[model samples]
Target: MIRLVAGYATAALTMLVLDGVWLTVATPRLYKPRIGELLADKPSLPPAVVFYFLYVAAIVVLAIQPALREGGWRRLLTHAVVFGLVAYATYDLTNQATLKTWSTTITLVDMAWGTLVTTAAASAGYAVMRWIGK
Candidate 1:
């Protein structure tokens, strides 16, 4: 129980920090220039909060826990990357299909960001679990 809680916290924190930085840098340079009209002056907090909570939970459950049980870094990374790719692709491709303003550059960049961030968070979760000895 303790390990699970700790791992989740670590992963969530890692993700939040990484994503915060990415958004701060990318929003102006990438998203705003391309999709400024689509963006709100200020983001809606409720959806962002919910996304973070659910995303972190999924990473911990699907990637971190399995890798810990199987005792392999390779397993953890593979699961993390696959989860990231699939999850991001679902969102990006859907937007590209439905939204006229969506761009291929955004899809590619966001997907890569998602995969990298997910793997980093999952790795952090795995490290915390191992450090605590479980």
Candidate 2:
């Protein structure tokens, strides 16, 4: 139980730190230049918080725990990448399909970012859980 909590916390923290940097640096350079009109003046905090919570939970459950049980780095990374790609693809493709403002470049870039970040976060979570269990 404690390990579960620790895994979630570690993954969430890792994700927050990584995504903070990306958003700070990339938003102005990548997103703003391409989709400035679509962005809000400031993000809506409530939904952002909810998204982090849910995403971290999914990572812990779907990637971290299974890898820990199976005892293989391959399993962990594969799961994390797959989950990230699928989740991000759903959002990116949906926007691309429906929104006139959405672009293929943004969709591809965001999906790549999501995959990298999710794998990093899941790896952090898996490491922390192993340490705690020992």
- Tens-place lDDT per residue, model 1, 68-102, is 88867999999999999999999999999999899
Q: Give candidate 1's TM-score.
A: 0.97
Per-residue lDDT tens digits of candidate 2, residues 62-102? 99988988866899999999999999999999999998888
lDDT of 1 at 27: 99
Candidate 2 lDDT at 48 equals 98
Clashing pairs in 1: none
Q: Model 2 reaches what TM-score against the true structure? A: 0.96
